[model samples]
Target chain A: MAELDLDSADGRREALRRMVTIRAFDQEAGNRFADGEIPGFVHLYIGEEAVGVGTCASLESDDYIASTHRGHGHCIAKGLDPKYMMAELYGKAEGYCNGKGGSMHIADVDAGMLGANGIVGAGPPLATGAALSIDYQDRDQVAVGFLGDGAVAQGQVHEAINLASTWDLPAIFVVENNHYGEGTPVEKQHNLDNLSDTAQAYDIPGVTVDGMDITAVAEAVAEARERARAGDGPTMVEAQTYRYRGHYEGDEEPYRDDEEVERWRDQDPIESFKDRLIERGELTQEEFDDLRAEIEASIDDAVEYAQETDAPEPSAAYEDMFVEQPPELERFANVARTDGGANGGDHR
Target chain B: MTAQAELEQETETMTVREAIRQGLREELERDEDVYLIGEDVGVFGGVLEVTGGLYEEFGEERVRDTPISEAGFMGAATGAAATGTRPVVELMFSDFMGVSMEQIMNQMAKMHYMFGGKAELPVTVRTTEGGGMGAASQHSGTVHTWIAHFPGLKAVAPGTAASAKGLTKAAIRSNDPVFVFENKMIYEQSGEVPTDEDYTVPIGEAAVEREGEDVTVVATQRLVGESLGVADSLEGDVSVEVIDPRSLYPLDTDTIVESVEKTGRLVVADESPLSYGTHAEIATRVQEEAFFSLDAPIQRVGTPDTHMPFSPPLEQEVLPGDDDVRAAIERIA
Candidate 1:
């Protein structure tokens, strides 16, 4: 039983829009990366869009979240501008982190979106600490750490959950169990059947939700948020979603069956949500097509903007190491200014 | 108290443990954001009782007791520091730092540099170091060299009661992440501590404990007191100058070089392993800065490259003793 406002026309439209936007954004990123226009490794979130959009639907604008490497959907769902994110993936200067943090390092701290960490199982502790700050300051906010199923086996993840639970910190841990911790299947890796069952060790509530349904995820997260705000401690919500694509863009995906991939595609989050909205009489076929086209045009503009933006100066690397750069950094920067860099030491 | 009266406040004899506890209490009272979190730091008053009365004075919120999970809470402290709060975490033994090295190196130390200076991580990690009580290799370690060798981490090890109080306060106030390596053996050693509420030993400064012109003895942690004792015993025989490099990472090389310049001889005694360790770094820097001023070769007194033995005789044989410092000075002087 989903408690989301699915009956409301505006709510349904917004959810449908978020899922569609993530699809448009990720597909464009995959294409650009394939065409060799984008630099660095790219992890696509095309298939598991519902887990991102739905969990975010229950959060306040000021509430914080930590994301994993495959984080474009989480960023998009958390209201990060696609133009800046896409530019970031393309390593353009106008990106969110000024091209300093490419795909895995993208962050918008002011938006309460703590960067997409390249290190797996790293986000849970950060989110737990953010919740500690919220609880210490007595703020009316909660934090969610979005991690992969693979992170379940990490010692830090267990510590994060135990700390949050013992202190009753305002944190919600949502494990996006996409059936594989990279190439290995969950069955081969874990002795337990359900990843959420690991939560019982911390003495907190745990649940498994249909990650393919946006409403189901939204309802579970909203309820967990309520429990956290009420000072009942943290809860673990395992979203049973699947990634139709490979782990990374060039993974070769020797891990799974083609039939299994096709099976997941049959339950594509975007197409299914779009049909639901049409069934609910919230939008006609023509209206739905118009919305899809608008999203495509917006994505096209992001690609154009990324291409137009200039690359960051090579010396931009030395600028952000510390608040006040130490003497060692200053000496190196001076050397780089007059030395063998591509910018010819003319940073000024 | 007025500035002159505050300066005139009586210096009291105290142990390093009490001095460190006073530092924690004053900082907790000074800022609401500062809290102490670690195992047995609350009702149990810490395993060694260095944080004994703090829990009673500050209550549960400020003086928190954590589970025996180093990586988890260390990572939590990093996150809290990046946000709005300042956290002071404790690792029971310096040897356990291996368990939490990932958080310490990657996140706590590198977050500011990686975020392009947009984030501030004002977190302090206080852990016990050294071996003298037969706590085996697993429990005893002087790992400050590894921490100091790492960039973005400021490290400190106070040799006396006053420096303990001062260094603890400085580590708490610093905007950067600092590691305070407290030697467990010196917890009971007594010295005069300044009674000022705001006194802080600035990081990267060295204290010339006993100034002499014949030989320079660079010491750290428990060896500082022992070196001073050695220098005293050699009073009329041979002149020995003892200098303590309180701050390890932002090392007080100028003070060290200046000492060697005057003495023309150098000897370093630290608790860590001798090879590729703190002593080596200091000795190499001394020679680089004052090679021409040297009268004899630089001498490093440290534990040989071996884990601390549990047996008393074996531990005594392996550990660098006060005699070691005297021998190094005698060889040069």
Candidate 2:
């Protein structure tokens, strides 16, 4: 594996930019979801931006990724247009999934962003499959599956890991150990303190990195990607992180102490990266302000674009339900007609 | 029959299992994207030898043999499907679906819908089902009805060699996840299957195996053969119409109802346990649709609601055979 130039001034500046983008996107989405501008459940990837940005920086457009419910950061990292993502959250016709998939299901196949799954531990199996495709098609592309500490308990994850090991799949399983599974800490849920131990059972190399450091995360992921490309099978990387927000938007802070949350916030990845850039004299205050303004303007444009986009047509609900409707559908139609209407009186 | 027709039939003599193998070989040759994956699918020749010689022809990658972990390979098939690869995974046995029910029900069945229809899963899971093979309770249960209960899945069971070959091809071509259930007992059953390499039997369509006017005998899976047998034995006395519903989920209820409407009576013969089986579902649907046309109450011929016994006599008593089907038809007629 090539040594990561994290010490470079340019690398520091880019890390700062990614953190800013992720923070801004999450904040905007959080507000939109709370205000009912966005539809469906939205799990903001607020405090854990470094993991997505750092790991994704090692990937290309052809490489695939399977994301968790907290997927905004992953989407941005994979180069999905913020405007279209916001539109998708807003349930607009121009959204990535044509408004059919809301916040929890945003996807762009062109970017190799397989949709963020609603089911825990679902992404690993999918990523494993995508890796199989890469192998079958004889491509150098690798697949990454993102999961939370909570998802590690899922049986499917174990199944996926076993298959990945057995077939020597070019895949990486990243577990963002954010200390909580919806307000319940990892200590209360799992027996083992370190999630990396799970990866060792599959005979794959497992490493733990500081999630708050973008440079460290990036270095780890870069090595994993190289190992995958060289046909060394799968790797498991556990990034120790903390979530600043409640499990969702409206939860009261009943699970932890205020001091702990404050301590984590003080070590925020974005602010730390910015400080590193400033100390190295790589980016001036004026340049930082300009980058901030540019990102804010782009975010504002995305919001405006989403707000102006139209909602999907009602007929879209019936369309694409099947690849090809069976002739026996006429029976359902007849049954529906006798029950008062073709939609069984609930056309809407 | 004409002398020319007799000679033509002689050339086409092949077992349902052989026809299925031929169909698989033809498909493998035609499409490079197609591949087979399952336990013992390679050198072991699939448990029943339905996939015999495929390993030698396609090599290890295409005719891959997987570990006993159904969930892992089944999930792999789903992933493979999403990536534009058509994988035909064998479940080894219908009863073993419990191991990978999550992949079959949640992922494979719901991917297209959950992904908002952006992707299509063109994967097929072929497995042996039903009793009469003497594989007993654990190995020989008929669980097609359990799969048919799911909405997104398409379940198929072909009785004849011709339909088996054609339907297997169709199931492979379908964009959705299709469960193809082959009867273990009918593997050696011979019939005149089409020699055409591209032939296909449409899914969710009912085949009128035998025509009659007195009563409709709706059957699926291995019971289709039993229904046909019952139809032949009652040829002189009672005219029994046999209807084979090849696919179960998108069931051809219309055809069954139409047949019931014509015959004014219905009897569904199923190899699964009598309680809450496909036979019950079909019987209820037929009665509901053609109630006014029915001359008698809809009846079902199926195994008593019990686990398949190991003993031959007990197994015979537990499973719905030709005698049971004949008795059911006679009562309805």
lDDT values, one for every candidate:
0.87, 0.82
lDDT of 1 at A168: 97
DockQ of 1: 0.34
- lDDT per residue as tens, model 1, A1-348: 222355578877887888889999889999999999999889889889999999988888888888899889989888899999988887776788878777887778778887788888988998998999999999988889889999888889999999999999999999999999889998887898889999899999999998988888988999899999999999999999998778999888888889998888888887888888778777888998899899999999999999888887887877766553444455446556755442122222
Which run of 10 residues does model 2 chain B get worst, by summed lDDT? B1-10
For A224-245, candidate 2 gives per-residue lDDT tens digits of 8889889999999999999888
Model 1 misplaced regions, further than 4 Å? A1-8, A90-94, A307-310, A331-348, B1-10
Candidate 1 chain B, poorest ten consecutive residues by summed lDDT: B1-10
RMSD of each: 4.1, 3.7
Q: All models, DockQ values?
A: 0.34, 0.43
Model 2 TM-score, all chains together: 0.92
Model 2: docking quality category: acceptable
Task: Compose the digit string of candidate 1's lDDT tens values, residues B228-312.
Answer: 9999999998888888889897787778888899999999999899889999888877776677889999998999999999999
Candidate 1: the clashing residue pairs are: none
